[model samples]
Structures are given as C-alpha cells and as structure tokens.
Target: MDETVKTPVRSFDIHDILKCLPHRYPFLLVDRIIEAHGDQSCIGIKNVTMNEPQFMGHFPGHPVMPGVLLIEGMAQTAGAFCIQAQERAPDAPPPLIYFMTIDKAKFRKPVVPGDRVEFHIERTNRRRNMWWFKGRALVDGQCVCEAEFSAMLVDTPTA
Candidate 1:
C-alpha cells in the first residue's frame, strides 16, 4: 500500500485560518494567508461581499466596509502570524492572540463589496511574548488603510 503524506503548509487557506484563529462566520475577517516568511511578516486576503452583516447597518444604502473591521482583519492576520512563528508540537494547545495596542491608523480609501482586500503585515519588533507589526490594507495596489499594531500571545487559560 502506498500513501502520500501532505506536508504541513506554513501559508494558510480559510480552513487553516479557522484552525489558527478563534474567529468564525461574520467575525473571521481574513479569508486566506497568501504569504508568510517565517515569523517576520505575512499577507492576508479578505473577499468582501454584500452579505457581510456589517453592511446592513453601517449605512442603509451605501455599503462601506467599516474601518474598524479592516483593523480587525489585520489583527486576525497577526494572530495567524503569531501561531506560525512559534514552534508547537502537533498536539500542543493553540495560543490566544490578544490585541495590545494600535497606533497611526489611517484610512485613505473606502473598501466596498466585491473588493478583495490584501492586508500586508510586517513584524517591527518582538519582545517577550508580545509582537509589534505594521500593517496596510490594499486594493488594486492602492492603500486603503494602514496602521501600526501590537499583540501578545498567551496560553489558553484553564478553568
């Protein structure tokens, strides 16, 4: 009998994103991670659509992807980065990524339905359990949003 073993991928699809991050459904902003270089940086993708819950109320007729959600997407991307950066056993529990800080956030363009947003994140600094990253959300090679953010990786708590 011959069997093929699928090598574990460092880059993430939606399923892998689900496994790495705790978010789901309307909350899971990142659709896929197209690129990741060790723990240094990554690029996450989000396919925006009219069905997203936020579109219902953000503006009745004009649907603009919220800036906060863009930040959230970037944070989720960072979460995946934190997971990929660490060396963990196959059965090891996944760590929870927590937002520490956000600075220098600016929205230069509006992201709307049908826009495929690419979030590019680069690690700026790492100390102890926290990591600082610079992120930019782009559509069609134009910057939509940019921010500097930090997050901490923590072991899941036991009850």
Candidate 2:
C-alpha cells in the first residue's frame, strides 16, 4: 500500500520560493512570506520538523536546527523583499540580488522540531543598486538568530 499525509501549509506553505530563488530542498529554507511592508520590512515563516535531512547528523537522538540555516532563511527573506521592491518599480528591469555581507550575527535559542520560525527583516539602508538589511529569526516572540547583511541588485543582460 502507498500512502502519504499532506499537512496544511499556508503560513509554511508557499512553494513559489523554489521558482523565485535558486535554493532547493534541504537548502530551501523559507516556507512563506505572509506580510510585507513595502521596501521597509517583511515577515517570512519556516516550519521546523524532525523529517528534515539535517536532523540525521546534526544530532542523532537530539535534533537542533542549525544557526546557519536559520540565517540563510532570514537572508532569503530579505532577497524576497528586494525582489518585491523591484517588482513594484516600473523601470527597475529584471534582475537578481546577491547577498554580500552579514555582520553582527547572533544566535540565541535552539530551534527544534515543531517550532515555527518567524523570520523578520527590515531595510536599514539602500544606495543605488546596493541594499543593506537587518534580519531576525524568532520563535514564540523570542529572538533566535539575527544578522545585518548587504546585497546588490544587478541587472542581467538581455537574453
């Protein structure tokens, strides 16, 4: 017999991120961005689970979500903000923004299975095509990870 259980995924559901970004399974961290405040800030959601591949080696009996993956989730959420910002502008043209630097990074609590990581980020600064952002990952309203990062929005040559 073949069977599968499909859990409801709205806050942690949006799969369009796979198409919008280059990240894939295991690396594809973010589940959805439920709220956005223009180019100012955004809120993304990630649902942690025991089924995640990293759980196997991160710890055999005890599983803990890696801080780096959490940061990636935050940065990716910022990338989405940049993408949405560009989409809002008529003359911005098609492009991709690459993360350049992350500073003042901090990891607080341990994120385990069944925890919903709410990623929040705010635009700190922007100049020309370069953008700077402050990001944080939270669980139950407590900070888990935070970082300050910069990115460049580049225009690709017409194909």
Candidate 3:
C-alpha cells in the first residue's frame, strides 16, 4: 500500500482578494488569483480597460498600461498569497503587507486596453515576516514585464 498527501490548490476571486488585500477601487490592479500553491507561487489576472483613470492622461490617444502598475500588481498577488498562507487565529486581523524593494525591473512591451495581463509570481526566499519574489507580467502569453521584489508583512496594531 502507498500513502501520500497532497496540498489542495487555492484560488481567490475579487471578493476574497478584497479580504486579503487593502487596496480598493482604481488601485486594485489584480482581478483574480487563478491558482495558488501554498506560499510558493500564484498567478493573478488583471483585465485592462479604457475606462481606467490612468488611460485619461497616460497618453492622449495611445494608452499604455504603466510598467510601475504591473509591478504593483505582482506585489499584490504575492502579498495576498502570503496572507492566505498564514495560520492565524480566527479572530486575528489581517496583516499589512508593505512593498519594501523592487529590483531588476524590465518592460518588454506595451500593455494596452483590452489586454488581459497575467501576473505570475513565485516566492524566491523568505525570512521571518519578509518575503522575496520574482515575477513576470504577460499579455496574450507573451512576457511584457518582469521584476524581482520584496515585501514585509506587519501585524495590524490594535487600537
């Protein structure tokens, strides 16, 4: 007889993302976390549309999704994964994740409205409450941007 245990895959929709992240409205770049494996990796999706506020002035006629926002979406995906992986008390407040560092960022192509950007993030290292991740942003299965970033998770202070 053989015995094995497998970790179930987790996924988060917009509502679940709202509970895991502090971002809201125009700043909430991630639309859904399609797959998560423990705290090691996850893939998030963002649907770009012309109605977004950034398109107003980012370019008068040619709108491109800012590279910085792509990086932010990556961070948010990893942050949400970390929060979801934590083993906390039922009544505990969600920890706050702060973007600490961004490195090796590169933009390969422009992401425009109607493009569905996918944020692929993988945890490269972790210590205490700090984590490091390498991420790539892809559109139509082509790499649009890539970066390595770190974040720190802080417990929410009680009032």
Task: Tell me, by TM-score, which candidate is best.
Answer: 3
Off by over 4 Å in 2: 1-16, 88-94, 156-159
| Candidate 3 per-residue lDDT over residues 1-159, each given as its tens digit | 657766678899999899889899899999999999998999999999999999999886999999999999999999998899999998788899999999999999999999999999999999999999999999999999999999999998889
- Per-residue lDDT of model 2, residues 64-109, tens digit only: 9999899889988887656766654565344666889989999999
Q: What is candidate 1's local distance difference test score?
A: 0.90
Q: In model 3, what is the error at residue 52, expressed in angstroms?
A: 0.4
Inter-residue clash pairs, candidate 3: none
Indicate which candidate wins on lDDT.
3
lDDT of 2 at 21: 63
Query: Candidate 3: where is the Cα deviation over 4 Å?
Result: 1-5
Predicted structure 2: lDDT? 0.81
Query: What's model 1's lDDT at 64?
Result: 97
Clashes of each: 0, 0, 0
**Each prediction's Cα lDDT score?**
0.90, 0.81, 0.94
TM of each candidate vs. truth: 0.92, 0.82, 0.95
Per-residue C-alpha lDDT of model 1 across residues 47-151, encoded as one tens digit per residue: 999999999997779999999999999999988877977888977778899999999999999999999999999999999889999999999999999999999
Scanning candidate 3 in windows of ten residues, the lowest lDDT window is: 1-10
